[model samples]
Target: MKRCILEGTRIWQGDPEAKDTYVDFKGSFRTEGTGRVFLRISADSNYTVWVNGQVAGFSGCADYPDFRRFDRIELTKFCREENELRITVWHYGIQTQTYLSADGFLLFDIYEGTNLLLKSDRHILSRINPFYRNGYCKSISPQLGCSFFYDATKSETPYQESVEQGPGLAHWREQKPLRLKAPVKAKITPSDKGYFIDLGKETVGFFFLEADSPEEQLLTVFYSERLIGGKVNGRPGWLDFSLEYKAKKGENRYLNTFRRIAGRYLFIECPKGLNIRYAGVCPTDYPLVETHRKFADPLVQKIYDTSVYTLRCCLHEHYEDCPGREQALYAMDSRNQMLCGYFAFRGSAYQRSNLVLISKGLRPDGLLSICFPAGMDYPIPFFSLVYVMQVYEYLSYTKDQSLLPIVRGTLDTIMKTFRSRIEENGLIASFEYPFWNFYEWTDLSHNASQIGRTKEDKTPKQYDLSLNCMYIYVADMYDKMTGEHTETEGMKKAIKEHFFLADKGIYRIDTLHDRYSQLSNSLALLAGLGDRELAKNILTDPDMIPVSLSMTTFLYDGLLKTDSGYRDFILENIKTKYKKMLDAGTTTFWENEDSILDSKAVESLCHGWSALPAYYFHILEA
Candidate 1:
């Protein structure tokens, strides 16, 4: 099938590489009694289409330039004879964990059938948006990108002809469109400087507000995943989850789909006599049709329900590590999310799209980047191996052999990358520089000092237990998938000789470092290096260094492989840990057991990878 012609010239004003800028395009199109019209659009960072000032759609899928995607939205009902079309595109030129630096441009086309009636050209007027203070770009986090200062009192610059680049190139994208869902009606109580509004539970997405003020006032909006002293903990250390909006005299209306926020509470600071019409977040939620799952035990059912909600909050443009902190997709974080998603959502489309997106993350050394569509180089090597397992699981669950071809080269390159790294010692060496050899948030990897170590930190020699075992595990999966041996048996033997501590009956992190972690031992068992009796012994020992919530699946996997009877043990273990969170009145599980994420204020109360019980429910229960 012939794809849509790259007809519309990519157009923008100002330095195409301006760090953080907002540009608006204004044009009018005559419908002329159209049979069926569609708004075909793509942008550098993000865009929102307003047909006569009504939000038609928002967001461009987080992507890279070589592997770009375009959205085709049907506008037959919204379009009229004299229609006004306005699109605002937020261009983020700086490199973040979630975005790659690219020239700011947009390709917009209104087409009826194949013939394009209107296209973005020099005629479509555009200019740097004045309402948003462009140079005052404050970051929410490295992953989520920019937060803006929107001024309703500011004047606008007259739109000019947009400078033309060449034609655009992209394939039509397929995903559920984001919809504005009403949150629970908030209860607003007056505070020292602002009013605290709670949506009653954890929520994800953008903020929208309509209010009437007695006079012109400047209001500061603060939001976060948790509260401090019964108020929103907006600013955590240096990170800012706060934005300022200047309101005019009478009624000020604002709904920014561009600046996204994820939290249950909003702190709006306003003057006296400011009447709030309806001020709360309208979640720009990705559609989740939940499977009606039931559990005989009430606590187990509650755990399953919250786990599903956690998964939903983290799933937006792509699978995020945490919607509050980093709305970026890491391979390992998403592997757990996908495992749970296969059960909760009961469909493979979103997971498949995300897997394909992950496949597009190409690096110079044939290793995938840390996050999808991110331009940074610091990657956790274990996550790349986990990605191999994710693709295999997708095929296993769906019995779909077709995706192998699309990701065949990627899978092959990842294997070759790891295979070449196997040293003369006959074991995979831990990466030293420019890479994070993180397996989990464990002391063995020494991640407790820094969640991800800096370039200066040196990892152990060639006997990293989790690193080698991960390679062996994924290599076996690849070999099984292709029926070609990766000779993992030899590597497994080398791992056993080097890392196994006979006295302790557990595997050490490396030969050089005398450290043992639940994850390293779990990986050893799963990779087929240890005996079943040893697995039973190591996993049951309370003295063993425990893994974090994200690594629970490995422990669970290793235990199940030991014997299916461990299912009861697994359930009880899950209940014991998760029950504490439930008892603490957590609606969504914490990023860590301590509710400590990066800093105290930035605690992600609703994290995605912590939602793995959703997967366990489907697997163990079924």
Candidate 2:
């Protein structure tokens, strides 16, 4: 296949030194007959396109420039003999977990059938947005990416008019159009703060508002995935995702296109006399049809439905971990998401794209980042091993051998990377650096000392049982996927020899720690190091380190894999856990039970990794 490169467009930048900048580009084209118009668009970080002040399209491909994806939007509805198009591109200059920040650039081409209409070049008028100043640092999580501060008082409405001068231009090749779906709106309620809207579910998209005020007022919009104390809490760590809009008197309508806000509830606070005509969310997600899978149990059905909804919310431009806090893609999260998607949504394209995107994120040291298309690099060694498992899963579901060639080098590199890290005891040792040795967020008392440790802690664990077990699992997966075999027998033998506590009939956390976790034991069972009896015992153990929300999927998976008869028990357990979330008024699965721990807050109520019950339901039914 020949790669198509952008010929006429040059990379554009508003300010060379600006960290987080917004650039606006405007161009007009006269159609000869106006039968139909198509636009090919791509931006560095993100972009939204408007035609005659109406949203024509919006997308930001999660990839590097060389392999950048572009959206081919059909503007037939918004087209006329004489038409104007405006594009707003956000260039987040700082490095983050999700976005790979680079120089600001916008590449686009317009066409009326075969004849070219207008292309993004020096001729087009472009300028920096004067109104949108970097306001408060409202980052839900440092990994998600930066938030936007729109000062509507500074200037005119964006996307409503074209600017005179702007940034330079950039060139990019065209890919497939982004999967688009109609935005879903939610119900609104009146409150002292202002209008409170409940999406009835979590989603990732822009906030829509229509209102009228007697006098000029500042409208503050607060977004949250979970409500605390029966109200939306904005202060979660350093994340206060409150966007202020300066509204003129009389009537006004607005949609936040600059930043995609993720939440299930919106608190729109305004001054007195500000009549909110309508307040709702324009929910966005990957284009996937609703699942037809059904269950007799209402609790199980609700869990399955909410799990599917959670997966949908996380399936935006990429498979994000959570739409509210960190709209970043983690290999481990996506692996689970892909598995659930196979049974629920049954889509393969997005799964393939996610796998390829992560494969492209392999660093110089043969390790993939915790997330891809990201600016700053934070590699989780265990996640890299999971990447191998994810690829195998993708192949198992889609049976698409095409991606194998693309990720062949990446697979080999990862295997070699892990192989080099193996200790003398045949187990993969924890790294010396502070590289996020996170397995699961177990209770503090269970594994208190092992929970949070810095690289400076010279105390050497004999071996990481969970990490080595995952390696063994992936090695076998890799061997099965490809023809080549990896010598994982020694690693499996070492896990039993070094980490297994025979007297307790369970696996320890490691040789150094006198503690054990469901995570390590479950991985041991899933990786074939432990038997069904051990798995059953671990599943029923009350004294063991409880499985966190994220690791619950693995625990259940190990249980089901160990003994098919435990299916009913697993299903009932899922109902017991998720019923608590439902009772707590969650429309989707949570990041963890931390939200319920205190009436004050929760991390994320709509996490993708927690959507594993959906997979289990489908797998069990089959």
Taking all chains together, each candidate's TM-score versus the true structure is 0.95, 0.91
Candidate 2, residues 272-361: lDDT per residue as tens digits?
656766666665556676667878877778889888888887877788888776788899899899998888875588788788778888
C-alpha positional error of residue 473 in candidate 1 after TM-score superposition, expressed in Å? 0.8
Q: What is the lDDT of candidate 2?
A: 0.75
lDDT of 1: 0.81
Alpha-carbon RMSD to native, per candidate: 2.1, 3.5
Clashing pairs in 1: none
CA lDDT of every candidate: 0.81, 0.75
Which candidate has the highest lDDT of all? 1
Q: Give the TM-score of candidate 1.
A: 0.95
Off by over 4 Å in 1: 1-4, 32-34, 271-273, 446-462, 596-599
**TM-score result, candidate 2:** 0.91
Candidate 1 local Cα displacement, residue 518, angstroms? 1.4
